[model samples]
Target: MAKPVLLNNITHQHLRVRTGPGAEFGDNQMAAPIIAAEFRQAQAHYPIVFRPTAGDGFEALALFGLAAGDNLFLSNDGWDADYVPLAVRRQPFLIGVSGQELTVHVDEDSARLRCGPDEGEAVFLEEGSPTPYLEQVNSMLFALHEGMLEMTGLIAALREHALLEAFVFEIELADGSERRLEGLYTINEEALAALDAAALDRLHRAGYLLPVYMVVASLSNFRALIERENRRYAVPR
Candidate 1:
């Protein structure tokens, strides 16, 4: 039996494990036991984070930033920190598994895995590889990718409803400065006039419109018109 490691409270919602070290496992195999073990005998300490879709029966671990001589555990059928790789120790994250088919989502450009019941479990690439930051980045990127299409659809719906035309936008900067952006297109002035101050504030808070100095003209040449207006009015410093 594999022993569980003594991990800091830092190990919380971010940890995951799959049946195998990699994703190529056949359906017939029983679910592999995933375990996070801390080595009391070893000087190295790498926490467990994600298990890539590869390497059957292998476990992976993570440490945010590790130095030499750090002891950690590598669990397959048992636990041992001696086998953990040294080169991967320096990286913010590491994947250590026997086989090469581990599917790891590293960055924004990586191909997203399809969503399904068989969406394989997450596991460690190696038993004692440090990868805290990398695991967080992967989790966030996957979430953003999954929701992007839905977000785009919502934006399109808002545009088609002409709800975007109700107001302008003004983006406040971190330096206490501001930039005014035009609304989606134009406002139905009559409808806007009917809105109370609170309603208008709600729209502005929701990013429907931005406030600016002045408007010169409504034309296909809006960019040129803005330049002309800025010269005359000297747009807010």
Candidate 2:
């Protein structure tokens, strides 16, 4: 679905990406895939929850809203959160495989990309090299790539331990309307606490304990999500 093209001066000398947020580029429903490497940071701001993938096992995500097309984080002003996930940060650009090398590819149809140099941030320097903004995007992409690679093993650990459990969230809006959010999973703390000594040691040795606990700790952010929603609906607009 993405019309990605290799980022090159000849074909994209006028590339500029819009700065700030407000879902200007139609990214209102950005799904922030939280990885173990960023659990500490992500847990501070977003509710880290696991969602099942189609034959791909589970993925940890920072909950941006209660449902699709409802990113409570985005407003006319900008993103409300302090920490934006790496997946959401790398917009309009992606890592492309060219032989054995990874190159930058820009989404040609992205609303973020502009034709004029006067607005947004330039992708390339006036002298033809990558700009600082592009460099940052490159770093974000590489980090996200590596983080995703690490998530496979982390999720496997949880699955192998049988720690994943299904959950459903029922919410009551300010107007007294009730909605149910389903098909989510969470780490089973009871089973985690029931693990034998050797099993605990194995998880600790594998550096899995912290992320598991991080997920447990992040569940509290659901309260934050509720607060944001309440505020959004409470407004006259």
Candidate 3:
């Protein structure tokens, strides 16, 4: 749970956040929600796909590993990938909404939080003000909040046009085993292409076309994910 970080929280001691990936910090999440703002860059690294939500709605995620509880990018040296998802980058700290305003919430039990210095990122200065690190987190939170609003609107537009279709991913592993991912959804290129001029205009007016194509383009990165897995296979066990 997050207690509202206030002057008392900072003045008494320090908010030290251990930087890097670790089980204690909860970076072990295999998939994370991402937005249109990140899709272009995320496409370069991970395969961005949409997963069905409980209410038949769709949400986008960046797939990190072939199996559950696996994150191929994580290592002793921190995240091995060149680009980390925005949701992953903003760990321990989350955005809270009070009516129309947003507040920053820090998970007290997070491994990122440390009472004192043991080689960790400080959330606040000794003088009780935001540090550069905390400032960056704030920026990320704001960007995420804004980006997600756009993402939600675009997804609704896709749904309006019936452009999303359920998909299944099948991979034949190096050991001759098969891995399957289901309950995922992707844009139907044919459906998108079949859109009438007026329908296309509506999507364009909502700034949805770019992101729709970005999600489609990201599927190619699945090959790169398999390559990452194959590297581990090359090592003598």
Candidate 4:
């Protein structure tokens, strides 16, 4: 249950957020939602893939682990990856929409919130001004909001070209145990390649060509993910 409330500096001036990566803060996710804006950098780290959403839509995700409730990048020292997805970084905070206005909302039930003076970074100054941390959160929220809108356009373009296909991932562990992953979708490279000049121009003009290629390149990171899993199980290569 999310207890979201409008963020106000006056009422929440004393609030502190215990930042840093940890399982208690809900960082132990196998995959996290991503946006087109993240593809360029995320491709170099996590395997970016598409998952089917309700109806005919699709949502992009950055795979973090092979199994449920696992995040190989998370450790006591913090996230192992150089780039943590904005979706993961913007925890316990959400953007709210009212008419044409966008508002910041905080999840009051999140463990990240602290009232102690020495516990974490303050969300606001004693004089009721936004802290640098809070400003960063605001930037993240706005970026996410804009990214979501871009995703809709990107997905629509892909769907228009019939460029998404479902596939299964089957891998064998060092112990000879097999794991099969399903319900995932990826770009149909063949279809993309076969697109005529006009269709290709449309996607390119929409500024989606680069991210599409980034997603394709990101599939190679599956090898890195396998290596991480093997290491987790202490399986020698």
Q: Rank the candidates by TM-score, best first.
A: 4, 2, 3, 1
Per-candidate count of clashing residue pairs (backbone under 3 Å): 30, 0, 0, 0
Q: Indicate the worst ten consecutive residues by lDDT in candidate 4.
A: 228-237
User: Which stretches of model 4 miss by more than 4 angstroms?
Assistant: 235-237
In order, candidate lDDTs are: 0.31, 0.83, 0.81, 0.90
lDDT tens readout by residue for model 3, 108-173: 766677636657887777777788988998999999999877777888898888888888888987
What TM-scores do the predictions have?
0.23, 0.92, 0.90, 0.95
lDDT (10s digit) by residue, model 4, range 1-237: 779999998778788988888998889999999999999999998988899889878999999987789898999989998899888888788999999999999999998884478998888987898999999999999999999988999999988898888889999976677767789989999999999999888899999999899999999998998888877678366
Candidate that would win on lDDT: 4
After superposition on all CA atoms, how large is the RMSD of candidate 2? 2.0
Please, what are the lDDT tens digits per residue for candidate 1 over residues 30-91?
Answer: 11111211212111322222222243211222322112222112224422324332222211
Error of 4 at 97 (Å): 0.4
Q: Estimate the overall C-alpha local distance difference test score of candidate 2.
A: 0.83
lDDT value, candidate 3, whole model: 0.81
In candidate 1, stretches whose alpha carbon ends up further than 4 angstroms from where it belongs are 1-130, 166-179, 183-237
Candidate achieving higher TM-score, 1 or 3: 3
Query: What value of lDDT does candidate 4 attain over all alpha carbons?
Result: 0.90
